[model samples]
Target: MALSPCGNQSAVPTTFLLLGLPGLWETRLGLCALFLLLYLLTLVSNLLLLAVVWVDTHLHVPMYLLLCALATSETCLSLAVVPQMLVALASLHGTAILSYQGCKAQMLLSGGWACTNCFLLAAMGYDRAVAVSDPLRYTTRMGHHVCICLVVGCWLGGFIVAGGMCGAIFWMSYCPGQNPLNHFFCDIPPLLAAAQGVTAPSEAAVLLLSLLVLGGSVVAIVASYGSILVAVLKVHGGRSWHRAFATCGAHLTVVVLHFGCASFIYLRPKDRYTLERDCLLSITYAVVTPFLNPLVYSLRNREVHTALHKLLVQRRVEG
Candidate 1:
């Protein structure tokens, strides 16, 4: 097969123009405005939650600690991919282009954030289950060391999975002139679509890795919560259900929203990939969900309010 010089030049200096939401030229500006609002809200809420959790020593328990880690991840989540999207959306010209290296960088960073989110959500489920099923030993079980280990494990796992996936996706062969990604960001579906020859292997590899990380995390979350449910039922009066539900309710909401959008984006085959649908899914998972996670926790979880109140009071007294 006589491969075109274009494929050979896939080396350095190769850039791809992102044709963001094609045929929606009139709507790009509106969408950009909406996303900008979302981006700002995500950053502010997550960062504030992080500050409260970090500074307030009262919030050093397992649940808050996990939340602190989540807020940090969400803060970085905006950094990983939203700016490029804003750039694409805001471009005066119809086309928005990114260098090959830049595109790969976006994908890697975003994937890392998403991976971290998955692991943290699962870990949180475990923490809640422990608090519900074994309140007496919850502190001892998820002690300082265990909490540190869990957070560290999430970071290491996210990095490894994201790095491997991004590396493989970018390293695959792309046919000549496949420069414009069908969607906004450099993502799996668009990347897979552009790749050349025997895509099954690459697709399988991506799917397996995704399932191993996301699917496995989801299973752990479900199992942990299921155990909590069982333990609640076994208790003398079933009084623990309220406490357990309160603890897991917000996290459960987040997990469902996160996994639902993520599964739609990641688990589907390439033939089923539709740009507009993928764009909406990405918005839900990548952009809106991060913001909503913090919002959900803050509104529904009373502990966060207490921690923030304590922090504010401390600040007032110090002043």
Candidate 2:
């Protein structure tokens, strides 16, 4: 039982209250509707991408396999954060309560998925690099077993890093009457603020772990893209260079959006944190970027369009 501000012990288990998107109760419903629409679109678009990848035998290569993993990660990330955000927004006071255990689970899932995506993007960059650099050897280099291992490694590394960070953050206890979390979901910065008994060592540990995950992934992506650039420039024909870049440009766009948003939120100092500003930025990574991923990939990739068309045509013929 946690002690309330009035010095009364609460009989119920301790929980954290989320003050969703601070200030704007009048616009909460509108925001809720908008987020719902985006979440639904995210689900549909990612699912369609997954279905296309699954049904098209032509897409059974390394690139689409990595893309399938990314789509899955985006959907899971949104599921972990957005529904609860909508519930919080629907509250009359724009606040929602989460059980202590529930909050921990959310932190783990959301953080884990976010980390997983960074690694997956990095893997995709490498896949593209290999495909462009050595087309004849691409299939052998990125065999099914290799892709499987990469996917498994990304997932494991993400969860392990997130578990460590979450462990460090949850090491401290929160008072029942502490200020509500400024963000909709259970994230690190707001939780750090509301927690008591947070020591310098724990804070330093979390920061170091974050740097390793984000910084290391950024390094991997840059290296992969650098190799891709070298390979593209070495190609003899104009069409070859154009084709290679076309394959990589969409990925670069997503990498920019995701890493930019994530870096802004996680890599910044706690002193620079603001309720309204961080919350809006959080929505970008958690909601908007996921929503944009499928669009960016599908709109730009002719292979995806062709695969989707074939799938639709096959369905009609089967019917």
Candidate 3:
């Protein structure tokens, strides 16, 4: 199959094959069971985290609010990729083909949510910095209205970025090849690789948008964290300094992992699309990061632990 140029597109095949992981057959059952377990755990853990943050009045603070947002993002991020992956694992086709519209929709939502998480992490860092640097005015500065606006802005920015990327990608023409993507979901790099040599303008469009979203988010995150580091160091008390640093450690861990893997995949030029390496990096952000975020944040948070114990006690008393 050959893809025509962007403007001169002919009737190309509508379906595209999704090349499943290489050597997957040897451990299909194990991989399926492992992913199924991770998916289940991710849903349960994130939902529980959201519930704890939402129902507990003591947990109703900016930090918990950020946690709730992260939990929600984790749920959506897993949903964007895991279901399709599970279907492919359960089937012998070994390749999941998606329609053009389906591919576009998946890319839009996934990209949008991923970008939102990037901004959210940066916002969370800023929130922490404010709380640490000016503890007396933390509540007044990060008021409810301001927090709500920040969250809304993160989502809005994500939508704008996603829409632009989707527009660029779909505007490009596809070639008349088997249209096999070597990843579970419709990511930008794999999609671009599949449509390579089709058109120069379309390729350029995708590359530009990818760099813009990835580069812009990374720069914002770095700037936010740079200020956060300065704030942490300015605290006089040793205990205060330790606490401030601890508060940000989890967020920083996730930011680094998410941005690191994403930069590896999206920021590189088109010639660097190595299927195996890309697949590994995709799993880092797509699968591992979502699974790890709740564990890292909730497990380290004493407030969540206390709330969970109270919840369990209340439930037991009711029972």
lDDT of 3 by residue, 1-319 (tens): 3534444334665556777787676776677788889889999999989887777999888878977887888789889988887777777766677888888888888888888888788788778778767779999988888888888998898879889888878776565535778887888888877674454566677667777767776677677667766776776678866786677788877778888888788877677789877886886788788888898988778888999888889889999
| TM-score result, candidate 2 | 0.94
Instruction: Report the lDDT tens digits of candidate 1 across residue range 1-319.
Output: 3344454554456577788777878998998999899999999888889888888787888888888898888778788778888888899864678777788888888898889989999999999888888889988999989998999999889989999888778767664443778777888888887776657777887898899888999899989989998888897564677777787889989999999998989987789988888877887787898889899999997778988888889899999
Per-prediction TM-score, please?
A: 0.93, 0.94, 0.91
Top-scoring candidate (lDDT): 2
Rank order (by lDDT, best first): 2, 1, 3
Candidates' RMSD to native: 2.3, 2.6, 2.8
Task: Tell me which residue pairs clash in candidate 1.
Answer: none
* Residue-level lDDT tens digits of model 2 in 1-319: 3432434445556688998766777899999999999999999999999999999999998899999999999999999999999999998788899988899999999999999999999999899889888889988999999999999999999999999988988887766543479889899888877765534556777789889888998899889888877887887788977887798989999999999988878876566777888889899999999999999999999999999999999999999
- Which candidate model has the greater TM-score, 1 or 2? 2
Each model's lDDT comes to 0.84, 0.88, 0.79
- Residue-pair clashes per prediction, in order, are 0, 0, 7
Candidate 2 ranges beyond 4 A from true positions: 1-12, 177-179
